[model samples]
Target: MSLNSLASTIEGAQLVLRCKNLNDSINFLTTRLGFKVRMIMPSEAPTIAVLSAHGCTVRLEMVPNATPDAAHLRLLCKPALLPAGTPPRLSGPDGMVVDLVDAHAPVHVPPAVQEFVLTRLAGPESWGVGRAGMLYRDLIPSRLNGRFVASHILLPQGGPVPDYVHYHRVRFQVIFCKAGWVRLVYEDQGDPFVLQAGDCVLQPPEIRHRVLESSGGAEVVEIGCPAIHETHGDPGMHLPTGAWLPERSYDSQKFVRHVAAATPWGPSRLPGFEARDTGISAATEGLGGVRVLRPATGPANAAVESEALGAPGAHQGEFLFLFVLAGQCELGSTVLGQHALHAGDSCVLPAGADYRVSPAPGLELLEVTLPARLPA
Candidate 1:
C-alpha cells in the first residue's frame, strides 16, 4: 500500500511485545521507562497491558517464552523536548531494547529584537475587548519577543460577572490588583475573596479559578510567560467548594496571595529602596520573582552609590521589567539609556544588561524578573 493510503487507514501504531512476567514488565515501563499505564487486561493475573509516553503507546503481552529479539522499537523526538536526565537507551524487564533518537529540530523561540517599550495612559483607543467582554490594554506591546505578556485589564460594568471557571497552561503568571477591588475564587481555596489595590496573587499553572465580581472601574495588571497559553474551561468543576489546601501543589507550583497591607517592607539590594516580596518566587520554583519597591523614608536624595551600583550586567533569562506605581525616578541601564519614569511608566530591560535606579523620595515601583534566582 502507498504510504498515504496506509496513513489513512491507521489511527495510531502501538508496538506489541511479549513479556515473561506482565507485572514486572508493567512496573519497569511505568517506573523506569517513564510511561503511564493506560490499560490492563483481566482484573487479576492480567496477560496484557498498555503503556504510553510522549504520545507513543505500547502493548505488553505476557507469554512463557518471550524474548527481547521479538520486537524492535525506535522513537524520535527533539533533544530539547526530552525530560532532563532522560537516558538515550533503556532496557525493559523482558530485555526489550528501546532506542531514543533526536530529531534535532530547532527550538521554538521568540525573535530577538532590541528591547524598547513605553505605554501611556490607556485611552479608549488603547482598550480592546477581551474574554467575557472585559477591556484590556497591552502594557508591554513587544512582550520581550513574545516570551511574556503584561496586560492591564479593567472591568467597566462590573458586579456579578459571568466569568467561567478556567485555568491556564502557562509556565508562570501573576495578577496584581491595580485599582478598585475584585472578587475571585480558586479551586481548593475556600470561599471567594476580594482583592484590593496593591494585592497580588500567583495563580499556579492549571489551577482552576474564576472571577466572581468587581467594583466598576476595577483594574488589574496580569503577567504571564510565553505571551500565549491555553485557557481551558472546567465545566465539570466549581471553585470555592472544597477544603482549602494551602500546601497543595498543581503541576509542581503552589498558589500565593500577598496583601500589601499585611506584608512588611524589608531591606532591598538597593540602599534607598525597601521591597515587599509578593511570594511569587516560591510559587514559580525560581522561574520568576515579583517585588513592590518604594524609596525608604528619611532620604530626600538617597542616591544609590555609583560604586555600589555595579556596572551594567545582563540577565541570562527572558524578561525583566519595572513599572512605576507612584512618584518619579531616573533609571539607567546598558539597554535603556538614563531615562525618567513617572507613575504608570514602565520599561523592559533586556537580559544581560546591568541597570540601576535612582528614586525620588517616596517613589514606588513594581519590579518583575524571570528566573527568580539571579546570578551574582
Candidate 2:
C-alpha cells in the first residue's frame, strides 16, 4: 500500500524488545509488573509474545544472543507500584530499566534571579525564527534565570498561521498586538475575533485557543512568568466553541481582551503621563497589570511634564518590563544608570528598583508589572 494509505490505517505504537527466553521475559513482565498477556506467536514453539501495560504495549522476540536497548523508559503512574521504602525503579528480564514517577507532581516555579537587562532594536543578532515560523527577538536574553520571559515577535510573512487549538501551562501570560492585526479564537470565548494594533489579551493558564491568521507584517509582544512553560495542543477542540462564557475561569484566571479604541485613556497613576489601562490586573486577580504610557494630554497631566511612568518610586512589583512602542524615551535607573531608548527597545527592572521614564515627542511605551496594583 502507498504511504498515505498505510498512514490512514495507523494506530498506536508498540516497543520491540529481543529476549533470550521469551517465556522468562513474559513471566517477569506479567508476574512482577502489571502487564497482561496479549498475543503469543507460533503456539507450539511460542517464540514471540506481546504484552500490554498501562497504555503501553511491548513485543518480545526470543533470540539466542539478544541484547536489550540501553534506552531508559520513564513512566508517570501511581507511586504505589513499588513497595514502601523502595525506589520506583526496576529492571526487566531484557536488562532494560523502568523508572516510575508521580503523575501528579505539583507545578514547579523557578526562583527569580533579579537583574537589569536592555535590548536594542539595532541588535539584529537577537531575532530568530520561533514557533509557527514567526520571528522572535529575545528581549530578556537571561530570562531572569528562567523566572520570566519577554519577546518581540513578528509575523513578517503573515496570513494563515499554522497554529492550532492549544493552551499554555503557564503561571501567567499576556500578548500585545504591537502592529497590524491577527484573528484569534479561544475556547468558550464567543466568536473568532481580530486583535488590532495596540490591543492586548491575557491568556490565563490552560485557556485553549488558536491563532487563525494575521495581516501582513503583524508584530506582537508576548510575556509570561517563569520563562519556560509548556504549550499543549488539543487537536480535538474546535475554535469558537460557540459558547460565550466571558467570566469563565481557566484555573482561577479569567481571559481579558483589552481593545485600544474602546478603552478609555486617563491620567496615569504616575505624575507626567496618561495611561491606557488594559484591565489585566483585575482579570488576573492581582497577578499583574498591563498598560500603555503616553505623554499626559489634559489638565490632570499638565502640572508635571517630566515624569512619565514615575519619578523614582511609584509602583513596585516583583517584576517590571517596558517596551517602547513608538518614539524615544530616557530611562534613568539609580542602580543601573541612565540610557536612551528608542522605538523597539525594551528594558527589564528588578522588583523595587528605583527608576524614572522621561518621554520625548509622541512617546508610546508599553508597561507590564506583577501583583497588579500599586500601593497608593
Candidate 3:
C-alpha cells in the first residue's frame, strides 16, 4: 500500500513543549506574545497549559529538568494578524523557542446591500475569442462591488483546449454547461468526464483540475467569489494520476458533479416554479447553492398575484445572481424597479435585497447564491 492510502485526514496540529515554570511561560506567551490561555492542568501549580494565538496552538508542559535547548515550536501566521515589528523568534521562561513565519492573510467581508444590475449579449460580432480560444463575457461587474463575477464562456472551435492542469484559490465557485459539451479531468475524480448542457460542477477551492476538450460552440457559465483569484499551474501534478478518492477533501469541501438530467425538479421559492438542485449546497457545507428554475406550465398567470408580484424580500448572503437560459421575465425590487430579462441575460441581485421575479411561461433561469442555507 502507498503512504497516501494509509494516511488519514488531519484536522489540525498542536505543538508540545517542555517548560520549567508553567506560570511564567503562560505569562510570557499571553502578555508578551499576545497568546490566550485556552486551558490549564490545575488551578495551583499547573503542569500543562494550552496557549493559542494567530491560528497557532501550543501545549506547554512543566518539566523539572527542562532546558532552553528543547524542542522549538514553528508557527505560520498572517503578517497582518501579528503586531508590527514582531520578532521572528521568541524565548519562553524555560528557554522554549517559538518561530513565527509569515503566511497569506485570510479576510472576507460581505457587502451590506446587494447591487441590482443587468447585462445582455450585444451580437455575434461582440463574441470575440480571446486567450486559449475561449470567448468570455463578464456578467456581473458591479454586483457586490466586484466581489463576485459571473461570466459566459464559449469556445467557438473547441477540441483539445490549449490549457494546463491548474487550480484556483477562491472562496466558492461553480461551472454550469449551458450549450454543447466539454471534457474535464480533476484530481482524484477517476477519469475525464464530459459535461453536457445542463450539467454543473462545484469546484472546491485549491482542487487541481484541467479542461481537456470541448465540442465546437461549447458554452458555459462560471460564477466565483471575490470576482478575482489566482489560477496557478501544477506542472508537477497531473490529473487522473492519483488514487481515485471522491470522498477526499480539499479545504474542507468535496468536489461535486451534478447532471441536470439525473436530478429531478423540485419546488422552488417562487410559486409555480420548480427547481433542480445542483448538489452544490451539500458540497459547500451550506456555503452556496445552484439551481435551474422553470415556471410550471399550465396557465400563463394562474399563480401570479398582484400584491406579491413584486414584493421584495431580503436575503442573507455575499453573492446572488441569475442567468436566463430561455424565455423572458421581469424582475423588480424596491431598489431596482421592474427590469425586463430575456434569453442570454444575466442579473446580479445584491445581498439583503428584497426582490421578486415574474417569469413568462417556459422561462428557464440558472440561479446561484452564497451560503446555500439562507433565511426564507
Which candidate leads in lDDT?
2
lDDT of 3 by residue, 1-376 (tens): 2434212222334587888887679779978999865544322124666667898888788989897556676555654545555677767767677666554545243453466778987777545443345787767655366477677888888689976677776788899999999999998888999999999998998788889999999999988876655554566687887578878888888999998888988877666677899988888789898999888665634333221223336665566678999898888777767788998998877655677778887788998977775553
Q: Could you tell me how far off, in angstroms, the CA of residue 254 lies in candidate 1 after the best superposition?
A: 0.4
Q: Count the backbone clashes (under 3 Å) in each candidate.
A: 9, 0, 6
After superposition, candidate 2 runs with Cα above 4 Å error = 1-69, 78-83, 93-95, 298-311, 314-316, 374-376
**lDDT computed for candidate 2:** 0.77
In candidate 1, what are the lDDT values of residues 1-376, reduced to their tens digit? Answer: 2435322423344577888988788779878989865544332125666677887888787889876664545555554545557667656666676666553322233664547576766459888766655777888776667677787788998688867777776778899888899999999988889999999999998798999999999988888776755555566686777779989898788889889999999876556677899888888788788998887777534655222224434555556677887788887766567788887777776655666778887688887877775543
Better of 2 and 3 by TM-score: 2
lDDT by residue (tens digit), candidate 2, 80-134:
4434564566567766676656655554678877688999986656677665567
The lDDT of each candidate is 0.73, 0.77, 0.74
List clashing residue pairs in candidate 1.
287-371, 312-354, 313-352, 313-353, 313-354, 314-352, 314-353, 315-351, 315-352
Worst 10 residues of 3 by lDDT: 1-10
TM-score for all models, in order of appearance: 0.68, 0.76, 0.69
